[model samples]
Target: MEVLSHFVRVSISEYFRNLPVPDSFVGFARLTGTEWLTLLPFVGTVSLLIYVTIQAFKAKPVPEDTKVNRKIQKESSKVVNMVDIEDLGDKVSYCRCWRSKKFPLCDGSHTKHNEETGDNVGPLVLKRKGAA
Candidate 1:
């Protein structure tokens, strides 16, 4: 193991030493005013494209039915309702269809919606541990 390690280290050092080195390094400092000006538009375009791509990926998706009717305007607001688990019973049925009179809670309104639209949308039923 020691011999193999020494051989590898020697081989790497020899390989690097045999590599050709440039007499002068090309950098921004070596560029003329004309060259810098020519590169500015290309750099700006690439930067703009990168920024737009990042923003597109970071953006959250908006739902198609975001515009609610005046009747359920308050219920369809951006504000989140915080429900206390202690206040709730063992089992709860949350509304999947927007026609619920109780807003978040299911009041069998999806049945009427299903009958009207011929859709099979139902409630999001939640059950607590060991609650029959």
Candidate 2:
């Protein structure tokens, strides 16, 4: 192990010394300050356009009856589920993550949102009103 480590270290040093690094930034030095200044607005405009297009696509309409909506968030780590209980006694368990402590039911465990960073939405609970 010692011999192998020494050989690897010596080989790496010799390789770098034999083929020294060149001034890779020479290409940038060729461009004047005006060139970079001109490029700044182009880059900013392109970035803004991309951001707007993505945001427009992200806000696409969701149906009233759909149970799950996907690709709504930037990071999209959490799921937004709208469970439909057709019958009076039917049970619905909206599990954002299967790691819920409440098993099939959501115990607010998804608040952590899979440890991802972004805006998150929780499950939707719909209850119809009946006249007594």
Candidate 3:
């Protein structure tokens, strides 16, 4: 067992000593301008990846309800409008502010509401699939 271990150690040392060392493996201080330029993109890519990973980990997740309810007001009126999908156009902007003279449809009345209450309320636009 002692003879085998010594032989293995000697073989490993010989193999490592015979391996060729790359010229670029020299210290960073010895790197030439061209070598620095060649390494720039790799360094930049690695830095960008690290930055993005950190940002992703640090980011706070936003709630879906908050996104859906943004700038929407709660009204006492629980009126629901029934409209035929076929009757609607390819693109439709429905009233969300409930201030529309054309109830259930947008007539750009939210602009006045926004101006009066300093609220940024807008229409809920619906679009049909395959309708550019």
Candidate 4:
């Protein structure tokens, strides 16, 4: 492990040493020659390329849970029931743990879910006495 760590440190130092440095910073912090100033353009180009590459590969930020929930509710199927009166037709589907492939309904998907997550969840079925 010590040898591996030493090799990593040496490799990182060599890699950083090869990275472009601004011409103004090439000399010692105390005293320096200005002849390297001509390399400023190359330094800027290298820095810009690095910045763009990093940004391109970065994952997009995720939305907050509340915002995500609101969006999901907007897109999800709705089930409403009427009370105190007889109706001919009404239906309600329950989404067990919101993991249903048939949203708000049971499609035996929970069996697979139980195996994977060790969760004991089941769907609820609702029926209305009358229709709207």
lDDT string for model 2 (1-132, tens) is 989898789975674465423357776666667666755655688799999999988977876634333333426477444434665233343555444565446677567764553537555343456522
> What TM value does model 1 have?
0.43
Q: Is candidate 1 or candidate 2 better by lDDT?
A: 1
Candidate 1: stretches off by over 4 Å: 1-70, 75-79
State the lDDT of candidate 3 residue by residue for 22-71, as single tens digits.
Answer: 36745677766876776676678879999999998896988564432233
Model 2 C-alpha lDDT versus the unseen true structure: 0.57
Instruction: Report the CA-based lDDT of candidate 1 relative to the real structure.
Output: 0.74
lDDT of 3 at 131: 87
Q: Please provide TM-scores, in order, for all candidate models, with all chains considered together.
A: 0.43, 0.25, 0.40, 0.31
Top candidate by TM-score: 1
TM-score order of candidates, best first?
Answer: 1, 3, 4, 2
Which pairs of residues collide in model 1? Answer: none
Model 4 scores a C-alpha lDDT of: 0.60
What shift in Å separates residue 91 of candidate 3 from its native position after superposition?
Answer: 1.0
Q: For each candidate in turn, give its C-alpha RMSD to the true structure in angstroms.
A: 12.3, 17.5, 14.4, 11.2
Sorting all predicted structures by lDDT, with the top scorer first, yields 3, 1, 4, 2
Distance from true location, Cα of 40 in model 4, Å = 1.0
- After aligning candidate 4 to the native by TM-score, how far in Å is the CA of 98 from where it should be? 13
| Residue-pair clash count for candidate 2 | 0
